[model samples]
Target: MTEEFLVAKDLRKRFGDVPAVDGVSFTIRRQEIFGLLGPNGAGKTTIIRMLSTTLEPDAGGIEIGGRSVAEDSVGVRALIGVCPQELALYPELSARDNLVFFGRMAGLGSRQAKEAAAENLELVGLLDRAKDAVRKFSGGMKRRVNLAAALMSRPHLLFLDEPTVGIDPQSRNHIFETILRLRSEGMSVLYTTHYMEEADRLCSRIGVIDHGRLISLGTPAELKSAIGPPDEVTLEQVFLNLTGRNLRD
Candidate 1:
């Protein structure tokens, strides 16, 4: 059996009367790319935050590499990297500088941080732009740098939240290739995306969530098999069928 690298069991969280995440559970195996699919306000980000150790669950448990998130948050943090939906880079800093800073923040020495910055920037195809100010780069370029910054720590698992949103197609494909390369090299990824096609193409298995509950979990083919037309069906249709057509804020 494949080893489970991360596990979340009956995770729960709430804000006042509103439940942000309610009894969510899933396990990610080594080298697997798991997709978390949900509409806005579906508690995807909440779950990501809890797993990344930024937020604590009110109930339940998260274990990464057999360490409890609530008890060993620092250890969990060390094992995982995060590329948040929002840009976390310093716009005024050069790409290399930003990465170096993040690497240092991850506790690498000056020389080691510089080396990691160079290596990761190269990995994201941004090494040529190393000295360029991030503010002057395009949206896709900024996103690439953000991804590289996350890699400075050499994490075993990665959480990418809308990594391709608002980017040009070429840049999007670049990011996709980068992700595939990481998976090829045995990195586990927890990918969250609104693009059904992306989820279809990249994820080995997907978990669909609505109202903070995991509504469906299956391979893309399996999910489509249940709701898709006999002749053909898109992931979007399966998503709509499971979560409804109502708009979310």
Candidate 2:
């Protein structure tokens, strides 16, 4: 078995008095697509932020590739790519330019960054639109560019938070294909989404979190088996069974 690419032990984060991430723990193996499946406000984003090193955990530990996030944050940042829930793009800049800017910021030299930017844009099927200003692109196109930017560094571990949000079916499918291809090429992914179907389709294993705690962790089949699946089993059914039907809002 491949070694774990990411590990979180007793991860805890609080917002003033309320706990946002309450002692959640999980491990993601190398080259696997691991899903952080939960509903809105389920602390999915909070866990993601802490794992990405954008936010420090109040209590607990995070290790990526056996390096402590607290002790080697810069090294951790160098080894991972993050595509956040919100679009991070320069509206006035063309897609190619935006990617080049981000790549350079990630420590690549100018010419090398531009080349990498072009390659990533091609991977996302956006090479033809590389010269188009982001402000003029459709929402789906912009999201694709955002993804390309994150991959400019060719990181070993990629963090994608709600990458399919506001995207068309075609774009979503394309993104899913790209994710699988990356995993096949030995890139580990920590995918965060409220979309149950996406998790069912892409994840090698799923970790279900609700109220800042992980409630279930297993392969799709393992999870279904645990709950005693009927003939027609789905991730939605498994999720509802574990988290219940009450509205989080």
Candidate 3:
């Protein structure tokens, strides 16, 4: 097997008496988007938090680029980028300014920050609107800027948590294209989303989580094949089969 770019082993986390992530383990290889699929409160964000070093796992461990999260969290942080589910942009700031500010915060010098901001804006197809205030942009445009900000660090791996949520179809497709292009350029991605088609289209491998546990892991084709006859099953069907069709609060 190829050496893993990121690895989570037996990860466990809890909030008071409730377990949020339990014994979840997975590995992401280079140049692939790994999808995390689940319903609301299925520990998807919790896992991303632990991997991104926002929260320490109550049990288990994570490693990035062969460095353990406990021993070399700073190193791990240096190699990863995170675009959160919520907008992490400054509404009053211009898109260029937002990206530059975040770039500097990620440890870039002023010149480097500015250059990276420009490059990422181009990458997300937002260079033309770089000077507009975030609040004046549409939802899709804001999301583009949010994603561009994360790339300021030039991270080898990126975590995208519901990056297309609440955006129009046009913007959603734009984000999808950007992700594919990133993978082509050798960026590994850990993508979490509730959209089955998104997982089916973007991810080389999909992990289904429910009740704080990883219930299944495989390529979309492999997963779909497992829960149905021949090639007839969809990722959505496989997910509902493994996680059940019941509503989750």
Superposed on all Cα atoms, the candidates' RMSDs to the truth, in angstroms, are 1.3, 1.3, 1.2
Instruction: State the lDDT at 57 in candidate 1.
Output: 91
| Candidate order (TM-score) | 3, 1, 2
TM-score of each: 0.97, 0.97, 0.98
lDDT of 3 by residue, 1-249 (tens): 346899899999999999999999999999989999999999999999899999999999888888899999999999999999999999999999999999999999999999999999999999999898999999889998989988999999999999999999999999999999999999999999989999999999999999999999999988987977637888888888889988889
Report the poorest 10 consecutive residues by lDDT, candidate 2.
224-233
- Candidate 1: worst 10 consecutive residues by lDDT? 222-231
Candidate 3: which pairs clash?
none
| lDDT values, one for every candidate | 0.93, 0.91, 0.93
Ranking by lDDT: 1, 3, 2
Worst 10 residues of 3 by lDDT: 225-234
